[model samples]
Target: MKVHFILHSFNASCMDHNTLKFCVFLILVGLLVNISFAKNDFENCKRVVKVWADSSLDKEIGEDNHKLRDLLFFLHIPRTGGRTYFQCFLKKLYPGYLECPRSYDKLRFDPRKKKCRLLVTHDDYSMISKLPRQRTSVVTILRDPIDRVFSTYEFSIEVAARFLVHPNLTSVTQMTKRLRSKTKGISTLDIWPWKYLVPWMREDLFARRDARYSRGLNTTESNDSYDMEDFAMPLKEYINHPASGDIVHNGATFQVAGLTNNSYIAEAHEVRHCVQKYKILGKFVLQVAKKRLDDMLYVGLTEDHRESATMFANVVGAQVISQLNAANSSLDIGDKIEQRSFPDSDPHSSEHQNSTSDRGASKVTSSESGETAELNITVGELMNSYEGCISNLRTSYSGRRIASLKRISPVNFSREARLQVSEEVLQEIRSLNDLDIELYEYARAIFYRQHKTTLQTFTEERWNNIPSIVYGITLWKVLPLAITCVFLLFLFLVIVNVRRRTLKIKMKVMKS
Candidate 1:
């Protein structure tokens, strides 16, 4: 009986051991399952960790339903935050879902049509509207107009000077003059390529006289053929054709076209245009685009005015939500954006510059690979990504400006530059030396003319109407002249008094 009890006791001990081992095995299996699920469910997009990635963090923040995959109609301005949004946020998060092709064609993310998900491009609002309902969500970023303008101008100057073999686009003066020959140097003028491109490409605007095939033609001959149904229109007629001008002016609002010449007119015209274009269907969208446009379309933007941009993004709804959420959450993503960035000095670094402007496929492959690994970023890299997005959105359409300035690299300014830049500006301005037209008036007129307004109109309205200093001197020129005259008068008085005293002293000595 005692032996029987001992065997039973041993059996009981074995049973307990087996029970413990089973529990341990189950726990291990559970952990592996959880890890696998985490890997599949959570995605690192735009180098930004989403709010839903960590359950504990999500619980703390009270964020739910984080996987509301949105349709993004990203209004990507060249240097704006679009690239960062695409590279770091959208690509990884959506994977094959987001339709942002690395090209100049507007992306369409059609889930059902797996042919091509992302459409890479440099298209405007009209194209953005074509995106599918479920696959596309629209959002855009804007910069302060003044800063945007300057950046666009600088970047255009940089790019043209760097990669493209530009002919006659030598200096800022030459750029302005060349642009003026076709269209004024308006604010939105930088966005229109046909004006400068057709001339620069030297593709005889008279080459193709096919109207039916003129959908995207940038020349008059192409349009004339369509209208005439025959190519009998004079070359000069075709050259100065409205269709050619329309190619430059189409899609651009009147204000954008007129901005370089008239702020008031440009603003008024653009505001009116926004009202007319979006009045039928895109009321909310137009309002958002216009509100954002006001910030970048008129003058330009500076770096400090970035907050206004954030707020601007918020008004556009769902698309902005992802951008904003990504921006806010990425603060903890390690050092992505650093102050001492090597990318700043080396424009060749894909991290800071967009590769779409010049070098083609090889450059794109290298560039994509560089930023592809940004999913594991530090805070510095995230910030850099954010700034890069803003830069791209602003400068995307201004490729000529990019080509002109060589924004990515330092260009050698040799007299051997290809563009045929002229020496003089105009005949009237050069002949105005005799009027001593208030230098202010002359300056204002010059600026106004560039903005697309006539000098006579600007002078009559603003400067000419001002009470002239009867001596016809501008305050800028007059102030210096007045100071000189006062000094000369004082010197003459001092010299005459000294001479009289000396003469009196000599006479007294003679009498003595």
Candidate 2:
């Protein structure tokens, strides 16, 4: 009986041990299953983490090994933030690889030497024809024509003000009289005075041109002797003058079409084709202008400068840098004048001299301060004029659909002094610059398309990398907890199995 009982107990003990072993094995299997699931989750996470490998920019980077051999020809339009672009971005990006020759004499190109990668110039579209078309990538920035004209006018005014200052000339009236007196040979009384004026002039009766006016004026000589003060009439007189067209004419088209000479005016009377006769060769000119614009790789807008810079950088395969630094570094006329006029002062001063200097310093300081104040006021007026001109352009294009356009305050005049432009003047400006307006609109459309494509590409690239970014973040947060839970569960299963084995052995001993 005792043996049977012991045998029965041992059987029970063995069964219990076997059952505990099975349970432990099952637990281990469960742990393994958990581990497998976690591993699968981690692997799924890895799939997302690897998304950056599919970036379009990555492809671009890979392809960057192939260096571009084409010369970047920048058509630097005046008053179009070209200085900032050239000095700040291009110079830094290309470093010692930029050539900016202001005159035709310095525009020599040597294929073998290839001294410059970038050729920036104020030279017109005609200049591009002179270069190897296959090897040149032409880029240019365009501004609102009216705004550009205003900026040019203001710049001329500022330059003239700095150099043509007279002690007796307290107001603009006195200054105008002085300028007229000095410029005796330069008459402002002609029916079409623009022909006799400098080619760059954009204001007053001087804005109109006649073929006869170009007969004696040499392009080179006129440009060389061009004086801003010579054309500095009172702003009121300029606006009221019948010859001062309602709006500044197609300065951009003229320059871009390579009509820098007076030939455009001279040939105005000769209609080469009957189709072009209605507007006196206007349609032909427009077609030619469009063709020239089409030849450019990119046409930028000053109004959308930031996007323009990005586009420029992308085309050149350069890392985008802020153009603001370069823009800020550009010296204004005021800064230039200040630098030239204010040389470093002497360090030495005698005690007696100092006493006298102190006595006179207040009077000198007051007088100088008053003069500075007046000059600043004039500059402010010029800036106001610039703003007013821009406003006028905006209003003209706003599609208000009114019979008569409301007149804005006159430029280069005080707020109290109001000037109104006739509808005839406004219509005339629109007619003259119709081609330029069309070109500007076309350029805007192109810019919008290019900008949209670039943005879409960038967005797609970012989305491509997002899965990897999320996976990495998930791994960082969830990995450690998963590992610890697995270890603790494994330890618990081992302990439970050992305890059951010991308890089964004790049961066997008690039975014996």
Off by over 4 Å in 2: 1-69, 100-113, 166-248, 262-280, 316-425, 465-512
lDDT string, candidate 2, 1-512, tens digits: 43345445555755777676655555565566667765675554434322322221122222222123356777666667765555434443432212322221122333443333467655555565456655566677888764564454444333333322223224534665676566422221111112223222323213221222345421221221112122344433333333333223565664455443322323221221211223433444555556555556677899997677666655443321222223224746564344224321111221101011121111111133221111112222323333444455446424321211111101232112212434454454455556567777777887788778778977998899999887778676888988999999999999999999999999999999
Alpha-carbon shift of residue 93 in model 1 (angstroms): 5.4
Candidate whose lDDT is highest: 2
TM-scores, each model vs. reference: 0.29, 0.44
Compared with the true structure, model 2 gives a TM-score of 0.44
Task: Give me the candidate number with maximum TM-score.
Answer: 2
After TM-score superposition, what is the CA distance of residue 359 in candidate 1 from its true location, in Å?
18
Looking at candidate 1, what is the lDDT of residue 48?
21
Q: What are the Cα lDDT values of the candidates? A: 0.35, 0.45
Q: Indicate the TM-score of model 1.
A: 0.29
